[model samples]
Target: MGLQKYWRIVFVAVLLALAMIYREEAERIVNIVVSSPPWLFFACLFLVVAEFLLQALRMKLVFSKNWAEILRAYAVGLMVALSFPSRTLGEGARIAVMAKELKVKKEEMAAYVSVERVADVVVLATAASLVLLEVHPFLLAAAVLGICTFLAVIESDTVYRKVSRGPVPELLRKYIEESRKIVKDRALFAAILGISVVLWGIDFLRMWVVVHTMGGTIDYTAVASLVSLAYIVSALSFLPGGLGVYEGGLAGGLVLKGVPHDVAVAATLYERLFSYWLWILVGAAAGAFKRENGSSSTA
Candidate 1:
């Protein structure tokens, strides 16, 4: 644990060093954000709140749980995701927390979370591919084909049955069974997809607003594609909340699209301020509150 803590300190120190090395750029970025109109900041904040509410609603729809509980679980998950190196563990944390809170089996909750994650990935990928269609037609085709194939496999009971019969652990079998039930529900699946579309749309709009706030002009599609690609790359990087990878990818992408370097950096920082850092703070608060209540109950 000491070694782990040491590495974390080193990680933070590295980030600080990088900031110091680019102090001029950092100052310029801060100036750009500070000079932005207050209304745009409010707009970004509104979108962030909307995202949280929508995600809670999505979880409620999937698990039939109270929205408040779902929101708390989600917040804690985000906090864990940012705290740890692997973002995947955040979903695992969400499953564990929600299952314990709602008195449901972990496998069952895993199924619901899986559905939510898969739907999000598919929707985001499709949207990104569509936006980049002019820039990458092959990418659109590949995305569509991959999505269709994945949906077909998941929709197939025969495939599930075959997989289930072949040395699958009992826990996994249960998870698969629950996932099939959720996916087979056409109405629920459609609603989830719709919510996902709106959620990602809000993400794009928020990015657009941040870029404009930094005095940069870029097309909506470009912003969407850039953000989407950056998210994918950062997730693959497995860094905490994508950390350095996300900022670098986003700022670089923006610069490639004709945004000034300082403006790009400013836009990325401002967007992350609301989207990533704000959530981390909220998650930390939620986690602490939960722990305090648990202690009080025990006492």
Candidate 2:
């Protein structure tokens, strides 16, 4: 454990060193940030708050829990996700914490988490495919076909029964039962997907605002494509908050879209400042608050 801790520190140090290596670009990023209008910063902050609230709402719909507990779990989860190497662990932490908080079985919570994860990925991929329609028709078709197939399978009772009768573990069977309950409710399923769409739309808007704040311009479609691609790359990279990978993908993609390198860097940094770093702070505060209330617990 100690060796792993040291490796994490060394990894972060290397990332910092790389940032300093580009002296001129780093200076430009600082200047761009300093010169940006204050209102835009507040705007981005508001969007972040909105995003979290929406996320909590989605959780409420899934878990049927009180608002306070749901938000606290979500904040703690976001914190863990940003601080850790893989998002899967953070989500697992969230499922455990929330299950304990609600006094429910972990398998039950895990079912909802699984569905939410799939819905989010499907929504993101669909958005990316639509944006890339003209540029990559094959990708659009594949994304569409994949999403449809997944939904059909999840909604099919025959498949669910067949899996249930198979040599599935008892815990996974419980999870599957819960998942079937969720997907069986067409209204609930649609509502969750709707929330996901709105959530991702806010993300795209936030990115657009960040770029404009840096005095850069890009169309909304381009912004959607860029943000989707960056997130996909980051999620696959499994880096904490996508970290260097996300930053690189966003800035490089923006440059490819004709934005200046400095501005692209500035936009990426500023967007991450609120979307990623700020959430970490919020999670810390939530964890501290829960602890202070004598409800401290670990995932």
Candidate 3:
């Protein structure tokens, strides 16, 4: 746990360094965002908050017996989004913390978090497939296949257990058990999936608003596909909320659709300023509240 704290400190320090070096670029981006109509800007903010609310509701559904545990789970989810890949361990830590607070076994929490993450992948793949014809068809097909495999493994108790028992070592028995639990919790998993999709949709809308503010000629499909692809990349970036990587990916996608490179860069930066940083502040506040209140998990 101490090591994890040290890693987080290092990650924050690195983010500060990067932000300082790119201060001019970041400021330039903010200027464009400020120039946009206030209503449009506020709309984007509303969507972000809505995303969080939906997630909170989903968490409640997932841990139906434990209202307090739901908050802790949702808080961890927010923390995961705020820090992203940089706090890779934070996801697992959140699960561990929930288990500790709820007096549940660690394996149970692990099962839940694992289901949450896998559901994210399944949800994204499904959504991407509906609009698959718009982007790289091959990649979309691959995503579909991956989603199918993931569902097959984690959503089936008999098959998962059979696979776990065959060839795999006895060391992985706990993993099999947890995966079975994930399968058993279908209703909660679906709820989380719905919330995850809605969250991503809100984020796409926010990006679209930023693009419009920059006077881009892009349409909804263009905006959604590009933003979705960027998210897929950034989610795996392992950087602090994918800071530099996300901005670059968004800019690149916009430029590919014929938007001016500089404008794309500026818009991406502005969206992050309002969205990412704002969420970080909210996550920080929630974390502080959790600590101060000595909250116990009810899972």
lDDT score, candidate 1: 0.80
**lDDT (Cα, tens digit) per residue for candidate 3, span 1-299:** 34434544776587568658899765665566677787876787788778767766655654554665565556555555456445465566666666665666777666666766766666556555534656568878887787677667766768766877688755356766765665667665666777777777787788887787788878866777777667667766666666656778879979888887667977887787666677656656766777777654532
lDDT of 3 at 276: 68
Per-residue CA lDDT of model 2 for 1-299, tens digit only, reads 24324544765687578669987777878899899999988999899889889888887997777888888888887776676666666567768876776778998889888888777878778767755576688876776687678667778889888988999999988988888788788898889888988988998999988897787888887888888877877866555667777889889989988888899988988898888879878988988887877854453
Compared with the true structure, all predictions reach lDDT values of 0.80, 0.80, 0.68
Cα displacement (angstroms), candidate 3, residue 261, comes to 2.7
Decreasing lDDT order of the candidates? 2, 1, 3
So what's the TM-score on candidate 2?
Answer: 0.90
- Model 3: residues >4 Å from true position, as ranges? 1-28, 65-69, 84-90, 101-103, 126-137, 163-172, 182-188, 295-299
TM-score of each: 0.90, 0.90, 0.76
Question: In candidate 1, which residue ranges exceed 4 Å CA deviation?
Answer: 1-12, 130-142
Tens digits of lDDT, candidate 1, 171-207: 9889888888888999998888789888888998999
Clashing pairs in 2: none
Model 2: which ten-residue window has the lowest total lDDT? Answer: 1-10
Runs in model 2 deviating more than 4 A are 1-12, 130-142, 295-299
